[model samples]
Target: MPTVALHHESIRLHTPLPTAFGEIRERDLLIFELTGADGVTGRGEAAPLTPYDGVPLDVCAEALAVYASILQSYDDDAPGVLMLDACREAADIPVALAAVDLALWDRAGRRAGRPVASLLTDEPLDAVPVNATIGAVDRQSAASAAAAARDAGYSCIKLKVGVGDDAGRVAAVRAAAGPQMLLRLDANGAWDVEQAVRAIEVLSPAGLEFVEEPVHGLQALRAVRERVAARVSMDETAEDMGALIAGGADAVCLKISRCGGIAGLLAQAALVRSGGAEVYVASTFDGPLGIAAGVHVAAALRVQAACGLATLEALDIDVPEALRVRGGMIRVPTGPGLGV
Candidate 1:
């Protein structure tokens, strides 16, 4: 096994990003690094926001400790799947498993002298289109943010609704962004079925691309979907994919940590696509490493819709060179591994 080390860090956000769940002012990350005998190192991050995912930070940290121990028992040349399976058996926590999986993939890509995306698929896109997020709740603030996003060359924008004044805020954003910009909403499962249907009906005049997690659970999602012409997407339901595969949503949002890293995310995306629903990657406000993993996976899959990876700006930390978003698109880091 390669040498393993773990570090904890808290990164402050540029501004408090408000959502239906709560406001996030800081992100806690478990940074994991693996160094091979040859002196090559690969990195991964485990970010657990308890308010969003219900996975406590210490829980994931403890699970990662177990995974590190499991890794030590393996040979330096152990198969990735074999090692990952062992870790999963020991601790079934997705967030911790995500960090281990990413580190392993990063090490493999570095060894093969290829980008992670290229290793995943025969053909991979050089870049993937990304959507800017507008977290402001008031009409003027939301409009100003939307206009700025449009002027910055963002073709798509995701607004946080189900907070308050949903109709007014959406209208202001629409007026500011114009009709051409793709508008999506994330309610964060704030509404019940009837409330979601009513909200979607009122907001659909803005020409929505989709509404994500308008209501919680598969049954509520199906009820809302039945009444709304606007497409409904699943985000929080990723853990309940058994019901998701039955086709209640028009799209499904897959996150790196939630899906247990890149490999598991791809496997889940396959299942989502098999059900005839579109699948796309979204960030859980992760750091550079996690965001880079999302880009690689989206590039390999050639996902058409704009992804939710343009989130680095929300953090106060410096943007890594390879993970920079250009003209509403994130270019796949051509360097070996995550290229950070």
Candidate 2:
């Protein structure tokens, strides 16, 4: 039989992470460790961002405990199968199941002496480009941040909008970044159909790469996309394949915790791609371990667009073995499992 252990930690952010939902000053992470009879261990993390992830911390913790108890009765011969069963049973707790799903993948990779990316796909990418996020700020501050990000070698920058003079902020960022930089915007579902259409129209001249979750529902999303010239990407509204396909957005953002895990993400990605839409891998301000899992997923999918994985800097403390970013790119971990 396999044993599971869970640990909880709260990390204080050096700088308050701002989003359209609110400012986040701290993050709570639940780490899980699964030890097999052979003495080999695997690790996973569950960090739920409230309002955004839908699942509360207390709820995820409870679900994880339930998952662990259920897994103990299963044979240790196939940890992956056990994880799948647990995930199916705890389908309501997607984030908690994601933690176990990743941990089991880690265990399997270690046992096979191959990286998780290798297991997911045969065509592994060397690295994935990351987008530097400019949190909601005033026009001047947004411009300065955009300039700094460009100077730091980040070719892609994601600007948070839907708060205070959004059009002006977009213009300032575009001016600072110039035409060469890939600029994207995330409204975090702060706008209505009218507001989203107006905002997208006003900021369309900035040459945005795409706008994410500008409005709430699938109907509103389609309306905004129809009214605006810029491409639309769905995040908050993309809960399932049906929603993603019906949302009519050009792209859908995939977060491992929200999508169940690597397996779930791959399935969604395939569905979205088959429908002539693109897929982007994003994060929930997770710690290093969770971020590493995202990196492997991005590599396995051979993502061509910039991903939202350059968020480790938002955390005050990171795992020592976290993946490193350079020249706006994060190198894929080559070691067995989720290397970091």
How does residue 90 of candidate 2 score in lDDT? 60
Task: Quote model 2's TM-score.
Answer: 0.96
Compose the digit string of candidate 2's lDDT tens values, residues 59-171.
88998888888777766676486557755676567788788888888888888888899998899898989999988578898999899888889999999888778888989
| Backbone clash count, each prediction separately | 0, 0
Model 1 stretches with alpha carbons more than 4 Å out: none
**Which lDDT values do the candidates have, in the order given?**
0.91, 0.85
| Distance from true location, Cα of 174 in model 1, Å | 0.3
Lowest summed lDDT across 10 adjacent residues in model 1 is found at: 237-246
* 86-136: candidate 1 lDDT, tens digit per residue: 999998988889999899889888988899999999999989999999989
Q: After superposition, how far is residue 282 of candidate 2 from its true place, in Å?
A: 0.3
